[model samples]
Every structure is written in C-alpha cells, then in structure tokens.
Target: MSAWAADRQRSRVRPGDPGWPSDVSWQQLNQQVGGALIKVESPIAACVEAPTSAACAQLFKSLRNPYFIGDDVALTQHLGWVDAWTSKPSAYAVAARNASDVAAAVHFARRNNLRLVVKGGGHSYQGTSNAADSLLVWTRRMNEIRLHDGFVAAGCGGHVAPQRAVSVGAGAVWAQVYDAVTTQRGAYVQGGGCTTVGVAGLVQSGGFGSFSKAFGTAAANLLEAEVVTADGQVRVANACTNPELFWGLKGGGGGSLGVITRLTLRVHELPEKFGAVDMSIKAASPEAFRRLIGLFIDFYGKRLMNPHWGEQVRLQTNNIMRVSMLCQGLDRGAAQHAWQPFLEAVSAAPGDFRFESSPVIVSMTARDYWVPTTLKRALGLVKVDDRPGAPISNMYWPGDQLTVGEFVHGFDSAWLPAALLRDDQREALSDALFASSRQWWISLYFNKGLAGGSAEAIDAAKDTATSPAVLDAFALAIIGAEEQPAYPGIAGHEPDLARGRRAAQGIARAVAELRKVAPNGGAYVAESNYFEPDWQRAYWGTNYPRLQAAKTQFDPEGLFFVHNGVGSEDWSADGFSRKA
Candidate 1:
C-alpha cells in the first residue's frame, strides 16, 4: 500500500497506546507553557466521589451559573445531548493564556499523534469542545478588549479605508464586549444574544443578535483575526492578508480551521433607544390558532418585515401564541403603533381569542440596555450570580437560565424563505407551522434571517461563508426540548434516556412538517440537529466546496477536526482516524 493509504488506516494515539507520550514529555510541555498545563478531571468528579459532601453541593449549584461553567477547564456550557454526546474531559489541558501558548500546545499534540480539542467559552451545542483521551488547548484566560477609532488591516493600508472597530480576545464573552462598547463608549458591535457566549466561537459560527437585522452577522463584521494554524504558525488573517484563510474563518464553524486567539470586528453607531414587546394570546380552539398564525404571518410581512424588528414569536401545542420580540432606533410610541393594527384585528374576534395579559411595550436608553443594574433593578428580567464576591455585572436573562448546563433532548432549525410570506403562499406556510406545533413548540427567530435587513447589512452577510439561504429567509424556525443538568454517574441527576428518546422523536416529526413546505431549506450550523444527515450542504450550501479548499490548504494533514465542521467528512465519527 502507498504511504497515504497506510497513514489513513492509523488512528490517533489513545491513553494506553504505546505511542502515547511519556510523563517526561508531558512535564516538558507544561514547562514550555509557563506551567499553565492542567490535569483535567470531570467537572462532577467530586460529586461522584462524595455525593453528600459540601464541595459537591456547591459544584452542583455552580453548574446553573454560566459564568462558573465558562471558567472551568473541563466543563462545557452544555452538559451534553441525549445519546448523541456527553461532556468528557481530556486527559490534559494547556490553559492557553496567549497565542504562543496555543501554538506550543498544537505542536505537541500533532507530534505526539494525539487527538486534539480547542475550547473557548465551551458553548458548542454539538459538543465540539470535549473529547476523551485528547489534549485540549483551553483559551478561557485570554480575555482582553481594546477599541480603535480608525483601524486598518496590516496589508490593506491604502486599499481598505480605516473604520471604527474593537479587538477582543477569544475568551471574552458578549457581556464583557457589550459593556465596553455599548455602555462605556456608546457604540455597537454585532454579537450573540446570549451574554456568556464566547466572542470567538459566535463570530466563527455566523452570529446573530437582537439587532442583527440592522447590523448583520458577527462574522460579516469581522475586520481581522489572529490564528494559530495546524502547523503551529501564528498568522494574521484579514481582507488583504491570507485572504483565503480570512474568508474561511467567517461562518466556517469553530475548531475546524484553527485556534483563533483574537478577533477585530467593525463597530456601528448606537441607536438612541432599544425596546421590546411581550404578550401572550390564547386561541379558544385549534381552528382559531390556525387563523391566528395566518394573521401574524400577513402582519409580519406587511408591517414588521424591516430593519427595526427582531427576536422571536412562539407557536405552541396548547393553542397559544407568545411574542417576545425586540426593536432598535424606535421608541415606545413607534413600536406600539407598528403593532396596533394587529392587536386590533385580534380584539375584533373576541369569540376566538383571549389575551393572557395586556401587551407590554417599553423602551430604554440604548446605553443602559446591557447594564446589569438596568436588567436587575429596573426591569427585573435577569438572574444575577448570587455567589459572594462575584462581579456585579455577572447577570443573565431569566429566560436563559434553563439552558445553563442543560441536557438537550433534541434541537433542530430551518430557514423559512421570504417567498413564503406572499399572499399566495401564506396559507401553506401557516399550515406547516400549526401542524409542527402539534408535535413540538416552534420558535420563529426573525433576527437570524436577513431578508428584510438594510442594504448594508445584507451586502455584508453576502461576503461571509454563511449559507446563501439566509439572505432570502424571513425567519429561522427552531424546534427543541431539553431537561435540566444531567451528567452521567450522578444518581438522581442522570439523563432520563427513555423520556429523551420520545422528545427526540417529537422534534424530528416537527421538523418533518416544516420540510414539507421548505423542502430544501438550509440550517444554521450553530443550532442545527446533531444527527443531521446532509450536514455539509445543510450548513454551507454552495460555499462548502470553497471551505474544503481552504481547509486543505491550511490543514492538509487534517490535524484540526470538529463534528460536522468544514472538512470533517475526511475523518471518522469520533475524529480519531481518517476515513479509509
């Protein structure tokens, strides 16, 4: 057999394999990284050893706090998904504090023929950050932030004009960046809606926030990045330098291209006010719920399909509709006026609808929107980290609390085309939505779709590696179910396998209903189903071939691999061996 064929047959060295590194080798690596190497253990190790101990109790309590989860070397934001994956700690981790440290770890892992994993905020729903018997490059300590008034890429001095931007370390979360950019400086940077999600991961995954309709995706706003490629070479990628690598980094999925140490993103002018609308409407029967869905779809297409509105609306099995949408550049009165016509239509049919409560329309100063004090003291819509001595800014939305360390039963998403909102097609679209909700709750996330965005926002998203489908999509319909933190080996906290399987089935059926209308719809890689069959096409569309070429150029040896990420089809399911 040829050398290439022989190499393809070999698997990465495991813990007990003869090719595994010796104790001296590990010690040498530790010294090279300034003694930042860590001997990892399961986050629940203490709980397993002594379930009744005070330390174990405290650890379990800390699991519910996203800040605590992100700070640990072994834990991921999600514990795992049922049957799909379980968070497993690597045998060792190099707690990377800088690009040089990350490069050193990469060199060691490649030379040792070891499985490698990279983690930042550890928020991958597909469990890309955790693997057993591997060596981890953990970038949780590289948090730093800097603002630039007129930034230009290194090699684009004259060709590219200077622009306002922010440089953020991989470990910095959205909350930190928003506090610095929006609250402190009164500027805006597009990022994830979840406060604790890592900046690097979200940007790499084509991030969406409450204001994405106005600012575009996080990846599209990327100005430059500092990356450590598989060959341990630290390179700067931008529009003018290493352009191919730069294109791949935007929406190509994290942990596949390289380890991103820092990213620079373009900043936009902050609007005067940020606002939200919350209300619940219950339909007396299934017939009324169908009409309600049809009415909202028509209203959304006519009035709300613009740069101002974003966020989600929910269609539930209990014949109820919930609205938790947001807006920017519009104050209380304008937001209210935009929705008055729809509210009046519902009120006219009292025999079919009942209001759970009066619609709450409110607006606040744009600068104070992300302030912890505003969410806690003024709005009472957030849950603060109660641990003594924690930073006062450590707060998350009350609605987001359920996802911290959650054991997901199932999750799936699909982009609904803007064409579906036409008067001729509204009935088919509404029928699919109402049918899907019978099996599971359907959430229509309008911000994730860029169809009716500003021309600047749409053009920016077109330049990134994200699926082309998003450009014409009015909303991303997400169907999912989950249970609370349930890691294996914890007696009472173990996953309910039987129940999870049933939920998974319902999630599948719900997605099937949507497929009947949007047969070839593309999915968002960041929130797609773990068992997606045609992932390459589903995630990247025509962009997959270009992404593969970039992957081959940068990582010909296939050193970096993540589940369903770019070029991942070349490796085995567990990413330990190349497919023969």
Candidate 2:
C-alpha cells in the first residue's frame, strides 16, 4: 500500500468510535501553530459553574484574538448574531496573523482531510463562515490600518501615491475606517450603517451606505485587493493585474474566490455637512397601511433620479410606518425645500402621515443626529447594536412606480396572509415561515450611475461585479417583519431550525410575489434570502457567467466555498460535491 494510504488508514476514526484522535493528538496539533489555539468547550457547563468565568468573558474580548477555539456559548452567540439556522458545531479554530499564517492553516486542513471555513467579522447572514466539524480560520485578529501620504494601508501594508485610496484590512470594521478618515481628513468611504460590520465582507458582497446615492457602493469604490489563492500564493488582484480576479472580488461575495487579505479602495471627500430627517405615519387599518406604502414607493420611483436623496421606510403590522432620510451637501433649508413635494404627498394621504416636524422637514447634521445615537461611546463607529432578529427578507429592485392598488395587492397576496396566522400556528410553523410574517421595510438607494448625467455615477455594467439590477432599482427593500412570535423565537437562546427553514420558504414566496410587480428586477446579495430559487441570477444578474469564470480560474480546486457564492453550485453545504 502507498505510504499516504497507510497513514490515512492508521488515523481513521470509524463511525461511533469511542475516542477520536487518540486524546493526545489534539493537543499535539494545537502546539504546531504559532498563534493561540483553544480547545472548544461547552457553554452550558461553563456558564453554570462560573457564569462570569474567563471563558464566557473571552467570547467578547477574543473577537480580535490571533487564534482561539470557541466554546459552545461563544460559537452559539456568534452564530446567533448573524444567522440562527446556519449554526453548527465546530471543534477547532485558528486565528491567522498574516498571509503566510493563512497558507499554513490551509495546508494543515488539506493534509488532515478537514473542511476549512474562513471567517471575517462573523456577519455572514447566510452562515457561510461556519460549518460542522470544520477547521475555521477566523481573520478578525488580523486587524491593522495605516495611512501614508496619499494612500492608507490596511492589513497588508503598502503605499501608493496620488493618495486617493485607502487599503483596508480584511478584518477591519467599517466604523474604524469611517472614524479614521473623518477624524483625520474629513473624508469617508461608502460603507454600511453599522460600525462593527467587517469592511471586506460587505465590500465583497456589494455594500451600500448612507453616501451611496452620491458615491456608489463600497464594491464600486474598490481599486485593488490582496488575496491568498488555493495554492497558498498571495496574489494582488487589481484593475491592471489579475483583473478578472479583481472583478470577482469586487462583488462576488466573501470566502468564495479566495481569502481576501487586503483591499485598496478609492475614498471620497465627505460633504462639508451631513443632514438627516425622520418622518412617522400611522395607518388606522391594513388598507391605509397599504396605501401609504404604495405612495412611498411611488415617491421613490419619481425621485430615483435624484442623486442626493436617500430614504428608509419601515412598515409594521400595528398600522404604523416610519421614514428616515439622509441628504448631503444640502443645509436644512435647502433639504426641506427639496423634500417639500414628498412631504406634501404624505400630508395628503388618508392615513395620519406627517413629518416629525409638522408641515416642514427638520434636518440635522451628522454630529447632531447620528453621533448622539451612541451617546459619545466609540468614535466614528455606531454603538454595537443587535442585528435585526431572524430576518427572513429579500431585496426588491423596483423598476417602475408602484401604485396604491399594486401595493394593496402585494401586501394582500405576499404579506397579510402570512401575518394572519395564529400565534400557535406560527410557532408550529418553521422559523422561516414564522419570521416571514414579521414587519416590512423599504430602503431607497439612489443609483447615480443609473440616474444618468452625474460624473460620479457608477456604470453598473462596467464598474464592478455588483448586480446590474441595482442600477435600475428605484426603491429596494427587505420588507418582512416577525410578529406572531418574536424572532430568534421565544426560546431566546436555542433557535428554531425548523422555523428558519419555513422562514426561508416564506421569503422565497414573498420574493416571488414582489417579482410579479417588477418581473425583470433582481435582489441584493447581502440582504437576500439564503435559499433563493435562482440565486445566481438574483445576486449577479448578467455578471454570473463572468464571476463563474473568475471563480474557476482562481480557485479551480474549490478550496474557498460558500453557499450562494459564485461556482457554489458544484458543492453541497457539507463541502461534498453535488455531482458525486
């Protein structure tokens, strides 16, 4: 027999084996790495004897550790934050300090015939960052940000002149970037609202932000990236070098093509002033709520071409709705004048809809409005807030205006029926279905590139790998909320997996109904369903084939795999080839 075959047979742990790895083997393997290595523990036991034990405390502090194995509670909490359904048990974890470290981890896992998972920020809603019985390379500890004359260096430090860009570490959070630039240079990048979200994960999945109306998505702002391919070679992918890899990295979703180590992104000057407004409306009944939602959708359809206006509307089962907005370069007076028409329409509505400031728009600067939300906690970063609960939602890329009539049909056909289920029925239903019966939200992202005429607008087709559907989108929303039973469910800690599945189905059905209103429209990958029926078409649109080619070129071995990512069709959730 071959030497390798003999070694494999000797190490094999047959099913139901009493002891896997011969006890001492795990410790010996742990000692092989330079960074911290931790043996996974049970959170329940750890919490019971020592509620305030070091292990429990380490869960929050070890977020930036170079390496550590998470206990059951740590793993559960981490998974719970992003996705409850995608949670699974993991026995080992390694925190990589640099590209070489990553290469070693990859080698170790491959030689051991172990599944490997790459994690950044732990914010993958689809739970692609985790797997059962997998070796997880958590990159959160590889955080570094440096600034040079014109350019800023992230984890993999490099200096480039003309200084128009910032190189961000794969593990760096968006809040860090925002605070660094705005505090030092009065600048900012198009990034997510939440500060703790990792820049690499969001950018790779096509990120949008408050400034996207004027600047474009975080992916569009990307100029270059440094990634470690399956062969363990650290390659720099940029517009001029490894351009296809560059294209794929821009919006192909994280942990797919490779482990993104660093990113160089073009930065934009923040407006001298940032302004915002909030408006609230109450509907007496479901019919009124439908009308108000339709009117808001119509407003976005007409105002889609406006580059400086951004609005977010939330709808609830209690016949209540709210609107929040951000306007750049415009003072309070100018912003009010610009939004007068929309304000007038709200007042004319049959529902009790009005601005927070009656008959006028009250705009506040970023300092006055946004900063106070966190009570001067962390500079530049929003206070760490919980993510929306067991959200079963999808993006609605509206191509045209939606009337109150159409809005009524949408709610009646897609939403209201789900919400009408009894509390017991909702509980009995899968988490996916129960969560789908929640609240509805509409987020308006103005695409300047699609708006035409603006020199700043990105050409969705040519600029990056982001879905072109966003280019034509007038009002995009993830409009589902949980009500019958609170999401993450009443259990609080242990999540309902069955409910998660049902919620997935509900989201799919909801998407199908919304698609009828805009058949040609597509969904956003980051805010989309985990099991989207035609995920490739929904996330990448016409860019799928190109992204697929890039995936094959850079990762032919399929080393970096994630569900719903490009070329993911070849692999099942367990890292097994579906073709087999």
Candidate 3:
C-alpha cells in the first residue's frame, strides 16, 4: 500500500483539482491493453492486477510516497525552483508495493510494447525517473521496511542492477527485513541520501555513510538479490546464482542487469543515539575560505586512518561563504574534544564573525518524521499555478572526492538562474528577501566518508572496487515545491531540457576530477553523477565490457528501449537502443 494513500475517498478530488485522472485516458488504456496483459479497470483493479501486488495486501494500489502526492500545481512549483529536475505528471504513476509490481509493469510494458522507467524516490537531477513518454514503474509505495531471515527484504522489491560487472552488484535504493537475532528485526540494506531514496537504487552507486569505512559500502555488505530479467522470469542473482550480475551491482550501478525485487544484505549491530554535533560560520574573505577548506582536508586524512573519527563540512561555492559543519563520535564528550581544533581554527580567522557552534546528541533510529503540514494544506497550494514550477538546478560538493571527468582545481558554474541568483543576493544586501510560505529553498547535505565509510572492515579482494581516499560526499537540494518559472512564455511548457543536460555535465566533471586525484576514489552507488556515454568508461574503469555481455545474453530480443534506459544500440540484439 502507498504510504501516502490515506483513503480512496479522502484522495478523491473535485473538478478544479490538478490532473484528476480523467476517465478518457484511463478507460481507453484499460480497453486496449494490447495482448496478454491484464485489462485494469478502476484504481483498485490496477492495484490488484499489478504483478508485484501479490506480495502485499490488494488494498495498496492507492499507496504512494508522502512526498509524491502533493497538490496539482506542486510539480510546476518545483520546476520553477529547479533547472535540471523533471516534474512528472502523477496520472502516469504506478504505486508499486513490491517486486511483483515491478514485474507486472515490465510484463505489461513488454507485452504492450511501451517503454518503461523504474523509479525509486526520483531524486535524480536528469529526470531519468520521468521519461518523456514511457511507463513509469514507481517503487515509492514499496516503502515498507522490515528485517527478514539473515537478509533484509523490502515489502516491494525496488533495487537497481549493477551498471558494469567490474563496478559492483546491482543493488539500489535501500532497506530490508533483518533476521539476525543479534540485529533483532533491523536490516542493513544501507539506504542512500534521505529516507526517501529507494533501497534498490542507493546501493548501486556505492553508498557513503559514517559507518562506510567500518562496514564498506552498502554494496560490499550485500549477499544476494531477487531479480526480474528482461524476459520476465524471476530469478536469484548473487555470487552463486549469477556471479557476474552480483559483481556488477557491487560498485557498478543500477538500471542495468534487471529490476531488483528483494535484497539479501548483511546486517550489523548499530549503536543507539550515536554522538552528533552541528556548527556553521561565515567567511571573511576568499583566502579564509580556502584556508578553512584546506584545514578540512587534514581532518579528512586523519579520520580516514582513525576508526572513531567522523566529520562533515558544508562549504559555500561563492567567494563570501557560510560554513555548516557536523561531527559524530562514540560519545558526546569525545566528539566535542575531537572538534576542538576545528573550533579553534574558526577563532584564528583574520576577522571576527559570529558562529553557531554546539554539541548535541541526535536520535539515530529510522523513525519517520512528521513534517508540519503548515499552510501547504491550508489554502491547498493547488489554489495557485502561475507561481509553480520545478526547483532550480543544484551544485554538489564532494569535499575532497572527485570523479573521472570532473576537476575541482578550477571548478565554477552558476547552476541557478542568473536573474534569480542576482536578485536574491541583491535583495539580501538590501535587507529584503522574497517571502512566500510555499516557496522552495536550497539545502546542503554533508555526509562523512565516501560509500567506503569506516575503516573497520578490509576485504582486499572485495575492496578492489572500494577506495580509502574519499572522506566525504555532499549534495544540494530544494526541500519542497515542484517546478519553478523560468520565463512566462513557451519555456514554461516547451521542455527545452537544457538545464538537465548542463547539470549532468557539471556532475560528470566533478566525478571525473575525483577519479584523477585518488587512484581509488571510493565509489558511492547512490550518487550517479551524470557522465556522457563516451566518458562513462572512466567511471566504470574496467567494468563496461562485462555489462555489455550480460545485456547481450538477457535482453537480446531488444524489446526494451527507452531514453536513458541503459546499454548502447550496438549491444541490443533487436536494434533498439536501451538508452535511446
């Protein structure tokens, strides 16, 4: 069931609402479902008839992620705020509850010959989740998490496959039921990014976490997977079942081998209320910023060899910047002591500045946070449209980590709309900033340790794909709102899509540069810094050919072809480009 599906009746919308699933399209599609595919009638029929629906109760079709089901104009609002994100139309969404749902979607797409896209939380900037015209298999409703057996199994299987055989296993998104008595019912499916990211997609990118150095990446911890091949057969993929596929998922990436349903992962005993700290500072000059950023590099080096040290810093790309910091340790006092040097560095600044520094223990268990509904509910933001659009393009800071093509030595780009950035800064200087309760704002994320987080575990053979040099990973985001406005003219709906392309290039550059610095820059399966196909080999290194071979064996029919899908046209047996 979708976490956001309150009730059919409660979700029912009246006439003035956004894209209220018109009887026209749904009815037509149901009638002409092609050949063997089942003809789904109402929302309930669509739910139960779904392939993955068998794993859970039939009452879940309406279920969706709490983040996905906002007002009609929410997408447009976000588009306005962002330059690279895609704002999907909700009517085309499938609220999958398990692996079976993904299987059903694949079966239906193949039978009906419709293009398909597998989605977890749809956090990608390239908008790969919302293809121009394709069947969207969304795993948002498959958010049910629990522990099972010695492995962890998601209520719905939404894991990603490995991109290249040499990369890693095909695990993406995150979470599962853990069965170890020591772990109780908890799982170690290692989720990436916010809780919203899927279990399957995260592990594919090499998950970065505070415990990565200790546990290895989420991919290193994986044991097995249940996959739905392109031909529609369900099978197990692992060192035993399909060793190549498993190898691909390790450090490889998702969206390659097949659609993952359930993941069998190695679970660990976690500590309660791990020590936490947060701090921020304003810079006086560019020299100070570099000095501070350079100081951080040293701490990063020490933390790499030290098992107990954990730290994250957020640096502004602008000349005059604000710094936000977080640190974690075995205990509060321990963390405070470890952070003293950083605090002293701030005091040694060339000029005086007010700083927010403190020590506070944070709750760590994975409990859902109840965000205040606030006015987003009061007036029903759907009550407005002209002001809505996708959020702005965001820049990420990998701290010291870099990629194969991206070089931070002289990195610079203005992802924000030029007008918007100038206006905001000028307004701030004038002591006036735009005020809108529903407006979306950019947020910086700081995570210590690349996917290969802690140094606790060392599997030389398994650690080949992993690296020890990377100390942190970070990303920028627009917390709320959908599309934002660029121009009132054709740009609003023209779908230029240049922003997505540019953002992808920028990320690619960063990743490329990192690959140059660290012979082994620690891979994070969850972060897919976009790279052009020609340059993709840089990210995968020696893993490309193996993935091509698997594609030839599994999808020879070439029945599946979609934009940004995967594989080149030459590899497709049927002359269809997987990423066409």
Candidate 4:
C-alpha cells in the first residue's frame, strides 16, 4: 500500500485523546484570528439548563427561523436525521471573517491534528457541518457580495476573456446574492431554490434553482474561487490556475477538498419574465391516479422538456398530483398556453380527477421575483424574518418554512433518465411513479437534471465533478420525511424516534420503487440517501476517481473531512478515525 494510504489506517485525535490541543495553543490560535474564536454550544443549551426561562422560550422560537439557525455556529438547518445523525456542537469555532482568518484556522487544525468542520449556511441534511469535539471554521461573518461588469480568472488574462460575473463570500446565501444580481442589477446567476442556502456550499455541490434549466447549475457557472486548502495556503482556483482543484471544487461536495473563502460565478442576462404554474389535482381512484400520472408524464416529455421550464411535480399517496413548476423567458399568456393541453385533458376527465383549488398560472418581471416588496404585494408568498433589527429584505419562501429546523427521518434521491420519458417507456415510468407514491410522496425536481438544458449548460456541467448521469436525466426523484425542531436531551423537543423510524422505512420503500425503473441511477451528492451503500458511484459516478486524486493531492493527511465527502471512505463513519 502507498505511504499515505498506510498512514490513514489510524484513528484521528478526539477531545480526550493525548494529542488534543492544549488551552494555551487554542488561545494562541484565537489571538491569530483577532480573538474570533468561539466556544460553541447547542442552540438549546440554555433551554436544557432552564426549561422555563424566557431565554429558552426565545430560543425555541428562533429555531423556526433559518437565518437565526444559520448565524449560530452551533446549529444546522436540519437538526438531524433520526437514528442516523444528530446536530452536535463542536468544541470550538473560529469565526473567520476573511481568507487570512480561514488560513490561520486551517493551519492550527492541521498542526494540532484536529478534526475540522466547515460551516457556511450549515444546511447539510447529512449533518456534515456538525460534529462533537471538533473545531469549526465558521464563515458566517465573511459575507460580502460584489458584481463585475467584466471579470477574468487570475493567470488567464490573455487566454480567457472577461465576462460579467458576481463574486460572493462563502457565507453569503442565495437570497442575498439573488437580491444583488437579479433584483437590483437585472441579471441572473444560477443558485439553489432555498434562498438562504450558502452560496459556497451549493456551488460546490452542483446547485440547482427554479431556472437552472435556462442558466445551468451554480457549479457549472463558477468562474473562480478563493479557497483555503489544508496546507494553510489561500489559493485562487479557476480554469486558468490550479485547474484540477478548480474542477474538484465544482460539484465535488463541500468541506472536503478545501474551505472556500469566496466564489465568482458567471452571470447571464435576466429573462424578461419569470413565472409559475401551481395546481393540485386529486384523482378519484387509483386507476384515475395512474392515468393522471401517465398524462402528466406525456405532457412533460412533449411540451415541458426544455430550457424554458423547471421546478417540480409531486406525486402523493392520496392519489393527488401537485404541479409547482416554474418557467422563465416566457410571458403569462405563453406560460399558460404551454400548459393548456394538460389542463384541458384533466378538465375533460373531471369524473376521474378534481382540482384541489383554482389552478394558478402567473408571471412577473424576472427582476421582481426576489424583490421583497414584490414578493409581498404581488405573490404574497414569503415568510419574513420577524426578529427585531432584521433586514426588511430578510424573507424566505413559505414552502421552505417546514424544513427550517426539521429533524429528517429519511431522505433519498435518484436521477430518472430522460429515456424514461420516451413514448415506449412512459408506461413503466408512470407505473414507477404511482408505486413510489403509494409508498411515500415523491417529488420530481426537473431543474436538478440537465438532459433538456441548453447545449452550453450541458457542456459546462460535463466539465464538473457531478455524476455523468445528471447529463441525461430529466428529473431527480426525491423522497423524504421530517419532523419539527427535535434534538436529543432537549426535554420536550426530543425526536419522535418511533414515528421517525416508520417514516424512514417508507422512504426506503418509496426509493426502492423508483429504483425498479432506474436501477443504476446516480444520486446527487448534496441531497442523497445518508446510508447509500455504494456512495462513491452514487455521488460522482466515474468522476469519483478524479475527485479522490484531487482530495489526496490537496488534503493528503485527511485533515478536512465530512460524512460521505470525497476521500472520506478512508476515515471511519464518525470521521474521528481512519479505517484499517
């Protein structure tokens, strides 16, 4: 075996380990970062100590606010996954405010042989950003967003031409970025659907948004990045410099290869309009539901399989199909026109299907979609942060509110190949959807797949470390379940283990149904099954080997690790020890 391989066959130092850093060392490192070191604690620690205190009451209320959870170094958007992982505060956190601070933290962690965790938005459903007895590099204080009319990568001034782009600090979230780039500047940058997701994490995980079909993934749009690698060097990674590292940073999974300080992403011209088609149709019987699924699949394959449409369609166990799809570059009339055939078909079959509510097909100026006032007055579709001194612009989708501090029971996803949409294969695909829904509700996120995207979009995604399966898949089928704000040892907020376990089994069965049609499908790294047996292939496909090489080159000693991230196979499940 190789020297590095042999070296990894050992345990990592933990809190009680003899090699653990001393207080003096920690203090010295804290001084290096301008006294930004924080002793991390559970968000509910105050509640655990005094359940009846006003502070505890306030803490419970704050848990529902994603921004509040994100700002805290100890918490994650997802509290935990039942029977799998729980949110745990690190021993200490370095509240990094700049690349220098990040590098200082990295150097300290490496020197002390510490298990390091990196958190920007802290939204990892897999609990990747949370670990007990580890040091956290918290980038929340580093938020800074700047736009460039024209920008070029470092060391490629002559080779690559300048392009319109936006540079965002690692801690900056999608809402903040969208407000600047789209609402204010009248341009578009591909990002995650959840507005508060950290830009750095999403890009590194192959981000998808409502309009990804038009602009491609956030990773594919990356122009450059400032990353602090494990060696304590702050390096600029782009196509022109540290090319291999740059490739790995795109869709290679976050907190593995390096700590991103900032990213510059290519910007595209904002479409004239952005729109949505919201409707729910409940079939009267199982036979009707099967027909409804078949009809929708046919409609999607024929009319909606293109760059103009994105978002999702939900197939529920109640024999209901919900359409929450979005569109861009199209006016209200055109958007409605595109759906007329499907709507007519459902209407004609009124005996078999019934509308849950009046179908909504609405369109608005693309620039206004993320504007707080527009969202409030025009759509009435946002939940604003009510905390005192919160920015008026601090708003999130109501749809995202349910999972703010959820403890997931189970979550799994698989890419459904575009071929499944073919006329000859649509029946099998429809049958799979119906069967999956019977087990658990399944959502097909069209934007997460790249098959019907523009050639430029597909070409760019191919260069990233994401699974090749994504290039041919029309949608990503996701099945998941969660409960509100549950944490172990938190008196009344303890997780519902019995209920959670049942939901987990249902989720597994649901995904099994999808697997019948897509048995060899690859899964998205950022949002996939936590207990994926063959994670390397599920996450990166053939790209795993290349990503592994990059991880070895940059983080040879495995100082940086996250659950299921590249090169993590060498380490134990808890990431505190290497596998023998």
TM-scores of the candidates in the order shown? 0.98, 0.75, 0.59, 0.97
The regions of model 3 sitting more than 4 angstroms off are 1-66, 69-85, 88-101, 143-146, 149-189, 303-311, 318-329, 349-535, 558-566, 569-580
Q: Candidate 1 lDDT, tens digit per residue, 303-394?
A: 99999999999999999999999999999999999999999999999999988877999999999988777536566787676778987667
**Model 4, range 1-580, lDDT digits (tens) per residue?**
9854455347656777677888899889989999999988775777778877888777878899999998888899998998889888999999999999999999998877788999999989889988999899999888899999879899988898789999999999889998889888999999999998999999999879887777889999999999999999999999999999999999999999999999999999999999999999999999999999999999999899999999999999999899999999999999989999999999998899999976999999989888778537455687777789988667789889889989998999999999999879999999999999999999999998988899999999999998999999999999999988777777777889999899999999999999999998889888888999899999999999999999989999898888899988888899988776
| Model 2 regions lying over 4 Å from their true place | 1-33, 42-84, 151-161, 285-287, 348-455, 481-492, 496-509
Which candidate achieves the best lDDT against the true structure?
1
Candidate 2 local lDDT, residue 317 = 44
- Of 2 and 4, the candidate ahead on TM-score is 4
Worst 10 residues of 2 by lDDT: 400-409
Instruction: Pick the winner on lDDT between candidates 3 and 4.
Output: 4
Which has the better TM-score: candidate 2, or candidate 3?
A: 2
Query: Which has the better lDDT: candidate 1, or candidate 3?
Result: 1
**TM-score quality measure for candidate 3:** 0.59
On residues 125-201, what C-alpha lDDT tens digit does candidate 3 reach at each position? 33444443445555544444334433322332345433211112222222122212113333233334233344566
CA lDDT, candidate 2, residue 88: 55
- The TM-score obtained by model 4 is 0.97
* Lowest lDDT block of 10, candidate 1: 2-11
